[model samples]
Target: MADQSSEEAARLHKFVDPVSYLSAFVSNGVRPDGRSCSTARNVTLNIGSISTANGSAMVKLGQTCVLAAVKMELSNPPLECPSRGYLVCNIDQSSSSLSEALSGPPTSEAQSLSQTLQDLLSRFVDCDDLILVESKLCWTVYVDVVCLCNSGNVWDACVLASTVALINTQVPAVNTDVELPLVSISSRRSLKLGTVPLAATFTIFKDKYCLLDPSREEELICDGTVSVIYFEDGGIAQITHAGKPLSSERLISMCKDGQTHTQTLYKLLNTVCT
Candidate 1:
């Protein structure tokens, strides 16, 4: 396949000469894929792909693709936050991924990625918006993410998919005016999303070349990775970093780049949803 050949070539290119591979970015002001340091990949959001799920979406960020499905279930509220609902995110990446870095069972890296993603997304989406019966009954939105391709920037893809799927989710309306221990359910209803969140990911190569939406090959050779989330109004929600430490200046630069990416993705998702 052309994709396989490209990955193979990228791997061989990096393997043969790490210095040259990294230098290509600094000297050329572009990556092997011909993208600028702060340019994100093309992102496409597809909604209602899974008919069985209450809501589902697939996001293709370049070669990285992730599927997110939202399942709504009426359940008792947590004692701590009885008045608010919650979103649970679980990510499952199969062992047979596209690259060597991801071709394995659920590793600690994957688990940590899942947790961090859930945490980042949690701040963007408000569970309080899903409350139907305040203290007694609230909807729990289970966001299940599956990574179908691992070209790179899976975090952004997952977030994009989850957000779009949630916006498309339709929660049935419930009538609490019925007799004791009985509730009437209206099967046809939809949730009104309060805020839309957009995300952008960056990978720092050798602590100098900060590439946006790095491919799997780029990630393997990169020093570290960071992802930033922004609300629809362009306000930042969360910033996550891993691998080589980043300086304050670098963090600020990444945030600035994230703003531009946020606007682009916001427009893209809005267009799709509309």
Candidate 2:
């Protein structure tokens, strides 16, 4: 029985190696998925997908899938930001994605991805817009993202989910009774948001190829990555580069491409949600 187990393990190792090498080779200039480095895999988003949450969205980027839910509750505004409400983001990676050999809490990879999404979202939100009252009470919005599947490019998937969830969210207006000095809570309404933000990530390989929205296999062979978040009006919200410094020319090209991509995504979201 032990011998049989050993043989199976060896076969598994053998199967994984050639696939890894082939993925690396493809990263140089070709993708097994046959997508150009600058092209994104097909994206599909479903808004109000979760019935329990106030607002929810499911985003699928290729095989990667993520669900984001937005919940709002009434709370006193913080002293520092008295006029603005608070936004909290939490991300969790499901254990099912990990191999049997890797058992533990979220790995560094997961934590970094979570932080990236948090920061990217922060850049687009105008916190002051969420304030309903001066210092007494305000809406606290909580966004939670769960990785339902790992098809690679979790950052992009999470960002897509977050964006759609925010758009779908409706903050209930506070209701007050006539006799209580407007102290009682009653009903709810949707918050007015000015503009939405979108993010696009590119993976650099062989110091030449810049693949947009890399899958799991392409990510392994890539030299580094860059994620750019853009707001409407052609303004950049955030830019993150990891691994090495990219040339200014490449950065410019990415910004140009990101603008076009952001516009495309924005239209898609509006069409689906409406």
Candidate 3:
């Protein structure tokens, strides 16, 4: 049985070579999906889908689907970082969707992706904005992301979902001093956020062609990927790259493209929210 499995794996590896070649050809200004190198797949954002969450959103980027839920709870600050309110992001890939060959807890890939998002969000959200009191209890927002489908570009999809969820979330006001505390929510209140940050991912193939928002097949063949996080105020919050390093010229071009794409995504989110 082991021998047969090994043979099958070898055959699969050999079969992938031709597909990689075809992907390389498409990366150079053409694609099997009939999209240009800089084009993004269709994006859809649905808000308030989860009843249990204070704020929730479902985002679809092409075939990739992510559901993010935000829950607000009163809690003391972390021992290490007590000055600011807590913001926790947990990302989990659905085992049902992932291949059996990739079994485990979140691999390094998922870990890095989560951290990148955390960094980008930290830059845009002022933790002080969530503070209802000084040293007492404050609202700690918890964001949970579940990737239902992995068609590619999961990072970008997750970012979009988080941003929309945050915008739609409403925190309940608490009267801590009263004997009969009132936990009433003012729906008209909006969270004080600084700016919205968007993320765009680009894949490099054949060390020459740059593909944006790659599909799962393309991701399997690519040499490297770069995910750039752009803030609305024309600032870059984070840049995460995996695999071989890309040239500075390519990096600059990708950043420029990401900036333009980010604006479009922001507008789309605004339209959906309104």
Candidate 4:
């Protein structure tokens, strides 16, 4: 009898107005996944999973998962920035993760997501640290990430994966001589990373509820999403959003909420490092 009732309710929630159904659940401080309104899904972080890459990490938040790998190569510095090397971040979402799969070329949404991640992450990484030699040769750190799943809170998952991967990365020593520089794979040196960067995503549903680390069902029915990126220096580096506009008061509260999570992430990373 209990199973039958539960199944019927689920069928009603699926076919009926999902927004209203979810709203009712939220107001009661319960979600379909059995978590409280403000609680986030489970997060699992694993590092150095890809042996071939210089560094690699994978982060799973509920059903959403992202894998990040770092590769370093010798390259000349840009003309304008002669002293610094490159810190590039490239992101790709698998077609299997899409709800309605598209044929032909890659979707514009995926391209836009990659560009957004690149812009936001560029500010947090210390590109100058990659410079082995001033102008002759430097390390180009390529951060390639692939989304294995996309249940929700993708931005936060990517941030977690990238940060962990960078922490695990090691650059080989370079020999600057003759015509060109040569890399000594035998002599690898770890990157000198400062405080790791962190991010938290807040979602607003309808015009009322503000959810933290929303799930796919909540994200789909939400009005907008605001992601706040926290820097090592105890300041927000970037705040980007999509969908409807959020109020100033709400945004401030969201930042505060995000800061708390940033602290938690730092603690988790510290454990990994040790």
Candidate 5:
């Protein structure tokens, strides 16, 4: 009876004031999900999981799961820049992943996320590598990401899955002798890619405590969130903030943490992706 009463009181506190409720846990040096303030959730990576796609990968960051697939299509290069090709990105959120059922087009948030991801990926991809025949036909690389779960930190998960999928992707051999290009489905070669880029997200509570890799519930109660994109070499690609402003010192500290997190992810990729 005593334990039940305690649980009831906890629920009441959470409903009345979420920030204070979360603060109670943080003051105790632990989060509701049993993780330290600085500790991130476990990450799982898999490559070439989808046989039908040219290349595919799946990433799991705790309960949040994302799948990414790459498809190659042939198209004419733009007249202005005939030497370059294209790298397109799209993101889809599954109905089961959200609180409500999705019946129509993607939500505005999903579209915004897709556009942001595309812009970030464009910085890494070299369209020159996509050219099959210069000034003629080129490969349009389509990268599709599907959110199977939205437990939290989805941006990082999407980036991880997309990067691995691109690494696993292969281009089919093309026969240019004929009027129409003949693609050999069985004959394929992998694209050239350099260092992979990844993202790390942090949630700030009450403008004081910074939590790494926040869960869905934590995100709801967060005062602000920061996302940092970086490469394996500790070079930052981008930093974005939402909700509240942060001090320069705090931003720099988060960047350092993001760099460290990227290095850890790179090592894990090497071990699991082969």
Candidate 6:
């Protein structure tokens, strides 16, 4: 009898108005995933998973899995920024990643996500560190992010993977002498990344409730969302809100809540990366 009732409820949830269905759960101070409104899902980080790449990591935010790999390529520096290299970031999501079986070209959402990640990483990474010979040549760091599974809150998982992959990266040493710079694969050096950058996402339900690390189902029914990126140096890399309007006090509170998660991420990275 209990199993039958549970199955009927699940069916109703799928076909009924998602917001109304979700409201029933939220009113009780819990989400369908059994997490409280303010609680985020567990995050797991594994580094150096891809041996072929310069650096790599796999991060899972609950069930969402994202893999990030870094590759170093030598190229001429940009004319305007002659001393700095490039940090290229890309996000690739396949049919397996989504609940819906999407095929063919990359979706606009994926492109937008890639651009957002690129912007954030570019701001966090000191490109000058990649300089091999000032204006002449420099190492271009390519960060490729692939989504294996997107249960929910994939954005946070991607950020974690990208940052951790870069943390694990070791650039090859270049001998600047002679006609052309000679690269020594045997000699490599790790990047000097100061403070780690991390992000947290929240979904606003109704006008008052804020749900942290929302799952796919919750996101579908959310009224609005807030994404916070913390630099860990008393600075925010980015804060974006979508869906609905949020008040100043609520936004500030959400930012503070996000910071705590970011700090936790930094500590977790330190433990695994070191």
Which candidate has the highest lDDT of all? 5
Task: Encode model 6's per-residue lDDT on 1-274: one tens digit a residue.
Answer: 9999998988787678788777888899888778888788898999999999999999988888999999999999999999999989989898998857489888888899999999888866789998878889998999999999988888999988999998899888889987888989999989766567788899888878898898988887778889988886647877888977888999988888788778888888889987
List candidate 4 segments past 4 Å from native: 101-104, 232-234
Candidate 4 per-residue C-alpha lDDT over 1-274 given as tens digits, one digit per residue, 9 for 90 to 100: 9999999988797668888888778888887788875677777889998999999999999999999999988888887998998888887777777675465665776677677777766765678887877876678889898888999888789888988898899888877875667778899878766656788887888777778888877888888888888865558877888878778998898888788777777778878866
Q: Which pairs of residues have clashing backbones in candidate 6?
A: none
Better of 4 and 5 by TM-score: 5
What is the model-wide C-alpha lDDT for candidate 2?
0.77
- Decoy 2 TM-score against native: 0.81
Per-model TM-score on C-alpha atoms = 0.84, 0.81, 0.86, 0.91, 0.94, 0.93
Runs of candidate 1 exceeding 4 Å displacement: 1-12, 98-105, 179-187, 243-248
lDDT of 2 by residue, 214-246 (tens): 887667767898988777677887798988888
lDDT per model, in order? Answer: 0.80, 0.77, 0.81, 0.82, 0.89, 0.87
Question: For candidate 3, lDDT tens digit of each residue in 165-274?
Answer: 98898877778787544678754366677778788899887787778888887788778999888887668987888889777988999998888888888888889989
Q: Choose 1 or 4, whichever is better by TM-score.
A: 4
On the 0 to 100 scale, the lDDT of residue 144 in model 2 is 93
Residue lDDT tens for model 5, 78-133: 88889999989999987888886385899887898899999988877788888878
Identify the superior model by TM-score, candidate 1 or candidate 5.
5
Q: Is candidate 2 or candidate 6 better by TM-score?
A: 6
Clashing pairs in 2: 37-211, 37-212, 171-189, 172-188, 172-189, 173-188, 173-189, 175-186
TM-score, candidate 6, is 0.93
Residue 122: error of model 3 in Å?
1.7
Comparing 1 and 4 on lDDT, the stronger one:
4
